[model samples]
Target: MNADSNGLSNAEALSRLIKYGPNIFRDHHELPLLIQFLSRFKNPLTILLLVASAISAFTGEMTDFVIIMVMVISSVTLDFVQEHRASKAAESLRRSVSVCAIVIRDNKTLEVPLVNVAPGDIVLLSAGDIIPADGFVLEADDFFVKQALLTGESYPVEKKPGPLASDSIDLQSATNAVFMGTPVVSGSAKILAVKTGASTAIGAIADSITRHPPPTSFEISTHRFGLLILRLTILLVLFVLLVNALMHKPLLESFLFAVALAVGLTPELLPMVVSVTLARGAVSMARKQVIVKRLASIQNLGSMDILCTDKTGTLTEARITLQQHVDPQGNGSERVLELAYLNSFFETGLKSPLDEAILDHKNIVVDVWKKIDEIPFDFERRRVSVLVENGESQWLVVKGAPEEIIGLCTCYSVTS
Candidate 1:
């Protein structure tokens, strides 16, 4: 095979890679532990509580000040630790899903790290492989791709190359195009990489995950509750200070009393409680084989009214087994198995799952046969025929969908 016939020369690929960054999915890293701790104090209530703790220290109330400091530090540390662990756990998962792709680079076939793939490079895809970048199909053989990870549709979709009649089309409907992160269910394809990194369709979806979503119902309710408590605390403190002043109490004493009262009224532990709860939920999910990247998503999961997903790879174990192999006469036939095994082993294009199933029989063997020529399977023809020679004898074996192949058969072999 000519190296130049496959894809870009090495120099060209390197130049394009320099122009466009490596293919990668970008994710937001969590803030530093110290920064996350400081973030806990960003809220008004936490700040108010800190001020009270300081005032207590200044007034020589050592016991109260120590208790307040301990509460603040304990809450901050718990929240920070849980979040840090969750972030690290999610990172491991992201790394696990990262895959490498086979490409033609410098005119030679190479299995490069997926992240190094650049736009315009040629990639070869086959069954059980994951696509690492977006591209148009240059050539295909019975190519079918399962993009349920992106489209939530379990059915494997066939891919083609011609331009659509209308430009307005959904990704699932784009037969001529393939996107990153999808699995090749069956068949094989040669693709011209056109997009990578943040520019690919899946990259856009990954970007969406980073941009924070609108506040959920639980968050809205929590915000309202915080505001309500803040308003009530302000009113109560004012009332107490006004009473002390009316009774001619010392100004300093009244001020300190009001400060203490305000601190007591505020729900300083709300944030801590929420964080711990979410962290625990994340831990539980991890134990049950679910990875929750964002802590806030736990609430959304609980509040979700409708959840929809495919069962093919999720709810059950999907596997193919050679349950039974029979001939036209409705009897088990070693001859049928032998012929099918020869077809699958010799006539290779994009190997189908059925071909795999047929080839799995332990008793099947075809070491004596040699392939001479093949009638390449095509969309319109819908059949594949292979001419094989065993010693001096040569015969053509054909297989396809029953509807398409039935008319071509004028005679039936009903014997074993």
Candidate 2:
């Protein structure tokens, strides 16, 4: 498990890849269409109605059997068609975005799909790049990572290449290790990947939740209703049989009478009614750009009066706005925005949220300015500087965290 500057050779990487398999969390699987459709009948109430329909058919009551079967089939079909279409659309949207990672192999750096990333690969990561797998930092320069997904701490944690202490028993204390699914907040690092795919920490969480989810509220209620109907039907059938026995009625006629009474008591159209109603909700929600994978979930959503979230930005569109541009004295300054717009417009590196907001705030005429050089932002510096020149003079425009910018400045300008 040792790595040098050249990283693992192609032969060795391929061998390890075959041994460990690809680095991916293959947690979800789609069932066959027939199986998915048949699964709808698993509902207790639906199963009961199905059994009642079969019994009616066997008892020479074709009319009763036809009515029950048609309602059940129509209900199941409506639910299946609506949900299946929505899920397919969701899948298409998901496939549009692909993630890639930078890997060093055969003494060359290459960008490859995240799934193709294998153990022993040297992964190069920087700001905004997600960690491809669990690995120890081999080389880092002021590297900081956001482990909020695993540790629930919103602040970024600094990581450097070093040996873990003997007391480092938990993930929170694993300072030298970077895990899968964590995003690099700032700076850059080179890691020797030790674990990939299901062996990684996040992959384990995905695997644990891969099984069938617990039944929803709608399912529980329907099951209870089925049990209630079963009890009442049994009681009524027994009472009818007893009355016929006391009157000395024929055995076949008495049994048929009991069966007819049970069929009459069963609500054949209830499933259809519920399915159609939920399907309508799904259609309306689709119009509003919400994908509904389960019709029953529509009911659950309707019942929720207050939606709670773990944090403010978690449910947002991730779009930030430039509310105001000001100088050091809290007075509005178009000069402040002019420099920001120039830097954001000419910078060649990855753009941050503030940069985007500045560009979106307003259009500034920048034809007179020509770019000269640039310094990219990193965790250590916490700021980015762009050197631009007009027809006569050059200006180094900087934008970053207020504290970082103030620390670097020896003098300040105030507008009053």
RMSD of 1: 6.0
lDDT of 1 at 255: 82
| Residue pairs of candidate 2 with colliding backbone atoms | none
Model 1 spans with C-alpha error above 4 angstroms:
1-6, 27-31, 160-168, 212-215, 268-272, 308-416
- The lDDT per prediction is 0.78, 0.87
Pairs of residues at least 3 apart in sequence or in different chains that clash in candidate 1? 10-106
Q: Write candidate 1's Cα lDDT for 1-416 as tens digits.
A: 12244588777777777888878866566567777678756555556567767877887877878877777777667766776776677777778876889998766799989988888888999999998899888888879998877776656788977776486368888989999989998888999888999899989989888775676676567666766776777788889999999999999899889877876776666667777888889889889988776577789889889878655455444445687778877888777777777777777656666776777756554677789999876766888888899898998888888888788988877772
lDDT per residue for candidate 2 within 1-416, as digits (tens), equals: 76677878778877888999888876588899999999988877788789889989999889989999999999999989998998789879967768899999889998989988888899999999999999999998768888878866655677888888899897867889999999998789999999999999998997786656787898789879988887888899999999999999998899899998988888889999999999889989989999998788888889999998775545665677999998878889999999999999998745666788999999999999999999977655878899999989999999888898888889888764
Give the candidate number with the greatest TM-score.
Answer: 2
Worst 10 residues of 1 by lDDT: 310-319
